[model samples]
Target: MTAIPPSPATAAPLGDGLRFAFGTLTVLPVRVTRWDRGAARTGMLCAPVAGLVVGLAAAALGTALLLLGTGPLLAAVGSAAVPAALTRGLHLDGLADTADGLGSGKPAADALQIMKRSDIGPFGVVTLLFVLLAQVAVLAQAYDGGWARGALAALVSATAARTALTLASRTGVPAARPEGLGAAVAGTVPVRAALLVLAAVTAAAASAGAAFGTYDLIRYALAVLAAVAAAELLLRHCTRRFGGVTGDVFGALAETAATAALVVLATG
Candidate 1:
């Protein structure tokens, strides 16, 4: 799949970007106003905003469950289900495909071919099992601490996951294929834009942590660092193994970063 250049007309308005972000990332019934490179770039930049909504909804679900006398474990399950259900498990599918591709250890072309298959491989199955379990477990721990802690963790983790997309789309990043989401958004994020988003996310995370306690502030910082590290590792690994970033890689990075953030928050 050879990469193609985006046309000048690909850019759209900010409202269109919001529509594209929600329409693409969630099962919400928002009408997508555009489907060009400009919209895609703006959509990726607004991804974290959508994530904030999803995370809040998820946290609310968990808090409600707890108030209704549900066990922390069950509340955690419900919280985890919110984003998965809302997103139609798109990120999970990406994580599965990426795991299968990387686990196969094949050359770039063959690995990409494997990822494109409809059937999930052994590696994909195992990866999904472990990742889901980890999410549930860590979320349960967070809930055990308190509703506010659990909700904050969910919100921050989701935002951090989306933040990875902006970094992945920054200039100099190549698309793995000529078509699809990766190609549309690749190299669209300027360094300045990426830095600004990163700073904003960090500030949001810090503020959220401050509401909990001093220890929580330290934990949140650690989680943010872990999320960033996970995203960087995924980007590097995908670039080396698949020649560049792909839609699947973006999905995998989001899930990995979210998991890392949650794990750090739950344990630290």
Candidate 2:
């Protein structure tokens, strides 16, 4: 059997984690440099950072549309489309597969096999619609009251997704075959870097909440935390059932967290 190559081992120990994570974002095939030392830095950071950038751009466009007299629905739809365009449907694809996998009622391996199929199933379609509807609902509500909060939510939610990746990588093992992107990132990211991303997201969330008197920062925080915890549990289950988390799981976690955040903030 061919062995999965480990991350690199040449770098200094202190910042190797960040370097490895950042490297994963770049266009380099640095998947397996070393294992014990936890050294490779291939292309993992790209997704979250890209999410943030795309989300921000989408929010701006949404806000601009609102200012130009577009209805809340159109603005919300446009904003949601930003990340979709940026990732070119990567997360959505994952989101769909994850929905199908988790909802299929098949064995874990069978569900995973279904996820690997190119065609989206009935469960996948429903999951995608639910996610999109949830996003649009929150966005429309936020825009009706205030676009600033809505935009900030978009930014922070995207960042939170990246942080979720870190949590998954640190806590869960990879699946049997180390062929996909999850294997490329597992155990390679630094906790500190992940914390930094979380901090940034927190700041963004707080700032957004502050704009509206109703922003119950603590409530939103707790909701996000809960979402993360739930995601971790799901990841752990996947690890036990399938040996590790996948890229689709990561994306599903992000979408779940973001949805939870919105719900909490809305209620708060």
Candidate 3:
């Protein structure tokens, strides 16, 4: 869901930024304290922080389940479910809508219209099924390695997913519509700010994996890059096809980044 906006907007405080990020991005109880462009810019920049929280929660659940002897498969499912639960499955819904829009092969305006619909079609259903399965498979692989490995997978992938949002909102990315979440946050972040955020996230991911082994350290670093690269590819295509970013496009980007990160962690 979008962040709530009130009148008499002012420049967002640090607290307002955090509130906006959590309030819009998750089912967390935090109330959005501001809704100005300043707040949105900060919110998009801090999107990875929201992701980090989600990832930690997801990792905790998976690790706990494993400690309780549920096995990796079930733990993987539980871990995978956490992000969806926390975000009210909005990102997943966005992904489905995006898939429908892309698969329609209609003119840009028509495709955008299709995505605005509430119902899921064949393209959306199939895309969601495969994406979910892929996420589960990779996460299962990670858990099979060890609970810690699985936890890292959840943590890094979710962070990467949110990181994608930061990049997608970087300056110059137009909004596909005149209103909605995309428009509010579109082009809000300067390119330099987005890169700095990416660098910080990649470094943290690599450092986290270092606890395991040298190989894991490098793998985790690559996972972040791969995730962002995949998302960037999709972002370019979406911009070209839809004429700019939409809320659905943002959701699709998150899922794409998360899936890519998981794949890199599992296989490399």
Candidate 4:
């Protein structure tokens, strides 16, 4: 039977859009404001879109701050805070748990069990430090160069990371049962929708950078491409190791990929 599409009326509107977006990107774990079992799958599908919107808003804010004479370091730092606010620190928690889980070196199930715990572990601490250092270094470099380039890097890198979520979703099974948001979202993403998002995001980013300098446009494009490749490899490895994806893995991928992208730009 053809499944009836999940509706916003029955689900959380904001959450539903996120689930739809995530489904497009293939990352899962979309939670509605009020939990609704029926809307679980739909919400998972929407997450990527929400993430994209969130990323754009952050980039815009950071770019605006830079234009207003804020240093890149301050602007980058400020921009980063938006995602934490929008997602209520959900991805940051995911980053920590995924690090702990991966670092545990236990069986996948055991590692996931560790992730479920509320306390942060050694792996989480190290991973967070690493990611933060990478981000700061890259952002600092971009800021030193100019505001437009930094904005392009931020926007393109963010879009690419969100796109990677779809690949992650496709590559793994849900870690939990009762078919949580992740499972429901598996195989539900539309390829065309994802491509369109990618195209639009890339175009906008490239245009912005080009307005500043053609060289910057090319540089950001290369960086963004490298970031996407790195994310694909990381997710592929994670999928193979764990037999599926998790919320933490998704967050980790986004942060890692974006940082790597920035670092690449810095070095080049």
Tell me the lDDT of candidate 4: 0.62
Instruction: Report the number of the highest-lDDT candidate.
Output: 3
The deviation in Å at residue 78 for candidate 1 is 0.8
lDDT leaderboard ranking: 3, 1, 2, 4
Off by over 4 Å in 3: 1-11
Separate clash counts for every candidate? 0, 17, 0, 23
Off by over 4 Å in 2: 1-48, 190-196, 213-216
Write candidate 2's Cα lDDT for 121-178 as tens digits. Answer: 9988998899889888887887777677667666666655555666666523554346
Q: What is the TM-score of each candidate against the true structure?
A: 0.94, 0.78, 0.95, 0.75
The TM-score obtained by model 4 is 0.75
Candidate achieving higher lDDT, 3 or 4:
3
Tens-place lDDT digits, model 4, residues 1-268: 1233233223346555555554333334543343442344344434445556766777788788888897888778766666666666666777898788878888877887898799999989888888877776676667667776666556666666665565444412343322344444444444554445556545665566677678767766666666667777766666666666666677777777677667777865
Instruction: List the candidate 1 regions with Cα displacement exceeding 4 Å.
Output: 1-11
Q: What's the lDDT for all of these models?
A: 0.85, 0.63, 0.90, 0.62
**Global Cα RMSD, each model:** 2.0, 4.6, 2.7, 5.7
Give the local distance difference test score of model 1.
0.85
